[model samples]
Target chain A: MFLETVLLAQRELRRNVLRSSLTVLGIVIGVAAVITLVTIGNGATQQVAEQIGSLGSNMLQLRPGQGFRGPGGASSDSKRFTLEDAQAISNDIPGLAAVAPTANASTQAIYGNENWSTSITGSTNDFLKVRNWDLDSGREFGDGELQSGRAVCIIGATVKKELFGGQEPIGQSIRLKKIAFQVVGVLKSKGQASFGNDQDDFVLIPIRTLHRRIAGNADVGGIMVSVRDADAIDEAKSAIERLMRERRRIAYGGQDDFNVGDMREIMSTVTGTTKILTALLAAVAAVSLVVGGIGIMNIMLVSVTERTREIGIRLAIGALGREVMMQFLVEAVVLSGFGGIVGIALGLGAAAAGSVVLKVPFVLEPGIVVLAFGFSSVVGIVFGFFPARKAARLDPIEALRHE
Target chain B: MNETPVSSNNNGAAANGAAANGALIRLQAVTKVYGTGIAAVEALKGIDLRIGQGEFVAIMGPSGSGKSTCMNILGCLDVPTAGTYFFQGRNVGRLTQDQRALLRREHLGFVFQGFNLLGRTSALENAELPLIYRGLPVKKRRVLAREALASVGLSGWETHTPAELSGGQQQRVAIARAIVTHPKVLLADEPTGNLDSERSREVMELLTALNRDRGITILMVTHEPDMAKYAARQVHFMDGLIDGRSTEGGA
Candidate 1:
């Protein structure tokens, strides 16, 4: 019986190959869209998470004068954090990994005959440790460089690639703001961070060099603090808050005039936003599957009306009503199964193409492929049921009489 | 499933004397009325029939004389409004649709006026259809279908579809399909109605041979007296009633 039905389906399918192919095509596009969108979204989110994780997970940034106002009820300047505050935090905070007070200024760096414009960041050696950065060559600024406020500099991979022409850039002097600074080291490439900024585009110098020689300002931008353990972030945050409030002489019940930005909190926010966006995009793609299912329903209805006489003949020949129903149901399932196969191929192709275009890794999840195929079949069964039942319920005598 | 028990040829239950003559079919006062109230048309008005085993019977009537309706009841294609139809000692009127289908597929084979062969099907496949419904293996069905087609003088024409065959040959294929299941009775309604005279005679000869030589009971409906001559018995119906009955001279 199964063989006869298979032969019947094959014969019928062969009779109208063009029509069957067209039906399968509808399902292909739907599955392909779902796979491509999901893969690209997944790849992007993975990239962001990796970048965020590579950064200092236990690090927190302390900005002075919260909400653009001072504790004295006066409008505060954005650059309210000072070198003195940085020193106070370093001295007061226990279980501290490292503290770096950073101030940045965009300036031009020049060698003997080469010149390049880049952002010059002034900070102590602790800046590299707190930011989870490592040097590829030479050494960091030592006590000698810091005591004399020597104009020594560390360049990033991009600056290395540009000025050094792929050569080893260690121990090479580059002038910043027309001041000559010895090249201490080249930092390893960190790629692009979650904030879309190139982590390797800046040159680092000592804080004294920037405040005394370049910017001539004692004010600091922000103090980055690396805690000893990531699990102690909450305790460290409250301690830092209390210390800063005391240092600034804030009354009890008064909000601290500063913001503590934890990397963990930022990571949660970033991932949460990405998950919502992925859902939104995936939901939009699912609508197309519904459209594809409706297409199956429409075609199956047409097939039923066209094959009324054939149905009558089978019924007269002792085929039970359920048998007739199963044949059509199986045909619908076969159609969707064919569509699923083609859709999987299309989806893989789309994902491959997307990886090249988006410049991100291509991830083909086995679970998603299985899900799309299963969903397509369910769509076929759910939508194909009505037409099959309608055909089964048809009276054989009436059907035989239909022209 | 051939569940209807075949009555023993030696049984002497003659309490219902009409059933004693070894009639394979007994229709007692069968009536089929279409619609209800004043708009109703009585297709068969209390039809009583008894056809014996191995008998080639023809029911002759003009159009609208309840002949086709009687055929429908005999074919088990429709149920009677109110009557008792004993097919091989079992009450067919009380049987379910599946039972009727099983009885038709196992005990009775049909040939229609239009030679209702599936258009795209080969002669062999058409012949094998009944066995397919019977759940026979493919190889066995193929072998049986080939034998049935060969019996109808259609050897080596198994692969030819109906459209490719001549009218006589198409009817032969239909006949092959009917006899493939080795049914107890063959029911044909104007089996040669759509054929030329030469083809019609050929179809009639095949039916006559099956009835006489194979001992298969045959019931045929026709209006032509010439067609009725091939049967062993004739039943003339008129105005929704049997007008007369006669036996054909031995061939």
Candidate 2:
């Protein structure tokens, strides 16, 4: 019976080759579009996760605020933490590995008739250890230079490539705001971080040097801390906050005038948000599959109406209603199965092209492929049933009377 | 007929002077009425019939006679509105639709006026359709179909579709399809209606050969007296009732 149904369906498909092919094309494009969009979304998410993991997983950032807030907000105006507060945290906290006072300002650097606009960060020698940035050449400023506020600087690789252009920049002297600073070191490349800013695109100078020669402000921007391990980060956070509250002479139960951020916590929150957005996008694309199923239903119904006499002949020749139903149902499933295979191929191709264009890794999961195929088959069965039932229930005598 | 299988079970009854004829089909007080109330039509009125085994019968009638209604009831394509029909040993009015279909497929063969071979199907495929419905294996069905077509002198034309065949050959293929299952009764309603006189005689000759030589029962409906003359017995119908009957080939 199954073999006979297959043969009959094949004949029916051959009889209306153009229409059947068009129906299959509709389902293929729908399935392929869904898969491609989902694949690209997943690839973008994976790229973000990788960037977060590559940044020092053990680092925490402390900015002066009530809690975490974006750049534009009403509470943006607040007293910045000073270098003394950073030193007090470094000295008092037991689980802390290193702490650095950091500040940044966009400035014009002059180097032998080659002056360029660049960003410069001022911090202590521990900044390299806290941020997990490596030194490409030379050495950090000595304690004598930092204490006396000598204008020695460490240039980032981007700044090095821009100002010196393939030339060794360790001993080169560059002037910032009319003060000459010798480049004592260069930092290694750290690519772009999750915030879309290049970590290796700024120069570093001594904190005291930045205070006296550059910004001439005693209030530092923030403090960056590195923990011994991930497990001790939360304990280290509370310890530093307690010490800062006591040193700043705040009354008991007063809110601390700073925010402590764990890199892992921020990453998890960002990943969660992006995942929700990706699912929402995928759901929107899924609507196309339902519409494609409806198209199949419409076409199949038309086929039933057209082939009334054929159905009558089969019913008269001892074929049961179940057999008639099976024939049309099998036809629908075959069309959808063919579409599913083509869609998978198209989706994989689109994903590969997207990865190349976006400069991200192509990530294809086998489960998603299985899911798409399963969905196509289900759509076929669900939509094919109405027409099949219509065919099965037709009366043989009346159908034979149809012109 | 020399091909008739001998059954001696009723030998004592025959010796007791009982007639040897056995009813292969029986219809009692059958009537068919279509539609409701004022627009109603009585297509068959109180029809009673008994056709014995190995009888070649012809029904002659005009268009509005009850002959077509009797043909429909005999073919099990429809049931009488109020009657008891005993086909073989079973009561047909009590059977389910699928059961009726099975009986038709197994015990009855139909040849329609239009030479109703499925369009686009090859001659051999058309012959094999009934056997396919019977669930015969593919190789056996092919062999049986080839033999049936060869018997009807369409051996080499197995691959030709209906459109490619002459009218006589297409009706011959229809006959092949009808007889492939070796049904107990062949019911042909104006089997040659669409053919020329020569082709019509050729189709009539094949039906007569199957009836006379092979000892298979045949019930045919036709308008031409010459076509009715080929049957051993004839019944004419008028005004939704059987009006006359006659037996031919007597001394």
Candidate 3:
């Protein structure tokens, strides 16, 4: 019985191919818009998480201010962390893997006829360990270099590409702010950061060398720390916070001047924003689905009226009321189901193209596809019920008599 | 007119035979009123009717004479407002709408003056519609529909749609559909009203052949005396009441 009804529905739809296609057009556009927006949004979220993950494994950054507003913008009353503070934290804090105090100054690096403007970072060997950075060639500064504050520097891949072109940069001399320094190593490439800054566009030198030649001060801008075990991150954060508070001589009930930011927190904030945007887009797209449903209802009502004689014939030929209703309902569902399939295909194609343009991963979520298709069918039923019932309740005598 | 009153014999053997070939449709004091109070029209006013099994009866009346209303009630398409209707010994007035539909589906077939075949559908599918409602499998439905179409002399026109066929051929397809289920009673409302003289004769001849060959009971409503001549009996209606009836031959 159900199969017969379905065939009847198919025949009826086939009889009016143009009208059926036009009726389903709204549903197609609605489903496609929802799927495309959600797919692109999810891809962006995944890309953000991946970029933040690439920064470091189980790392935290401590700035000498209440927040990361900018360089040299710390609270005037707050004291900057010195190299001693970094060493103290490394020795005193348990579960600590590495701690590096970093200070940066933007300067022009000159080598022969080539010169490039880039940020110059100064830190100990532990900076590379905390950042999970590795050298492409050459070696780190020796202990003597650190102790005597030798004029030795390590250039990042961007600096090397800019200053030396294709030439070997190792054992070469580069001048930073008029002070010549030997390039002892070249850091490996680390692509763009999550915030769109080039991670490989800087030069690294010993902190003492930077203080003497560049900044002429012993103030460290920030501290980068890595925990040995992922499970002990919270413990290490509290331990370092307590030590810094005591060393800086903060009284009881006083807020600490420095702020520690976890990489996980940054990752969550970015991903959360993307998720909210996705939900909002989906909600707006859902309104289109409702509009599509209304379109279906309007067309179905028209169909019932137009086919009154046909419905009457079926009813007189012994079709039960529910049978007539089922035929129309099946027609509606088939229309929306076809629309959903075409919409999914179009949406996925658009999403893939968008992913390439946006430089994000292509994430295909199967659950959304099923949900979209199912929801479209439900829309047909919800909107189609009234017309079906109206058709079913039609008086066979009057319907047959209809002109 | 050869008129014979209903026999009153109470013999057990005769009663069994009479019951076996008894009235397939019986209406007593059936009244159908349209609207209410001053606005109401009595479409049927206390009609009493009996159509025996295997009898071809023509209901003849002018417009608004309630012949169509009688046909509607007999076909289970409408229920009487105040009366008891019995079909094959079952009280039809008390049956629910679905039950009446089931009775129509199983034991009755209808032919409309408009042909009422679904447009754009092939003659074969139109013929198979009743069987589809009967829940016959596709293979069996196709076979039965093919046979019914052949029986109506439309053997080569199975795939032709109503628009593609002539009026006579379309009426043949309608007849094929009406008899596809081998219904016990076929109710045809103005079966030949739309056709010209030649096509009307053809459709009447086809209905007559179906009755003679299949012993299928037929109740047809027509105002044309020529169309009424095809039936074995004629029941005349005037103002919603059966004014008179005539039998063509002695039983």
| Candidate 2 lDDT | 0.81
Candidate 3 wrongly placed segments (more than 4 Å): A65-79, A105-118, A137-153, A159-185, A209-217, A251-255, B1-21, B245-251
- What are the per-model numbers of colliding residue pairs? 2, 0, 0
Error of 1 at B74 (Å): 2.6
**Candidates 1 onward: DockQ, in order:** 0.35, 0.37, 0.69
Question: What would the per-residue lDDT of candidate 3 be over residues B1-251, giving only the tens digit for each residue?
Answer: 11222333233225345443356666778999989999999999997666777888988988999988888889998889997677886777889999999999999988989999998999999999988778899999999999999999999898999999998899899999999999999999999989999999999999999888998999999989999999989988889888856543212
- Evaluate candidate 1 and give its CAPRI docking class based on DockQ: acceptable
Best by DockQ: 3
Ranking by DockQ: 3, 2, 1
RMSD of 1: 5.4
lDDT of each: 0.81, 0.81, 0.87
**lDDT tens readout by residue for model 2, B1-251:** 11222243243224423122356666777899989799999998987676777788898899999898898888887888987676775678889887988988888888877777778889999888888788898899999999999989998999999999999999999889889999888988888788889998999999999987777789999998888888888878888888756443111
The segments of candidate 2 whose C-alpha lies over 4 angstroms from its true place after superposition are: A1-4, A66-79, A107-120, A137-186, A190-196, A208-216, A234-259, B1-22, B64-69, B115-119, B212-216, B223-226, B245-251
Which scores higher on DockQ, 1 or 3?
A: 3
**Taking the tens digit of each residue's C-alpha lDDT, what string does model 2 give over A236-337?**
888877777777677898886777877777677777777787778768767877887887888899988888877776776666777788889988877787
Ordered from best to worst lDDT, the candidate numbers read 3, 2, 1
Write the number of the candidate with greater DockQ, choosing between 2 and 3: 3
| Model 1 per-residue lDDT tens digits across residues B1-251 | 12244354233334445444456787777888999999999888887777777889988988998888888778776789987787887788998877877778778887877777877789999888778778899999999999999989999999999999998999899899889988888888889899988989999999998887888889999877889889878887787877756453222
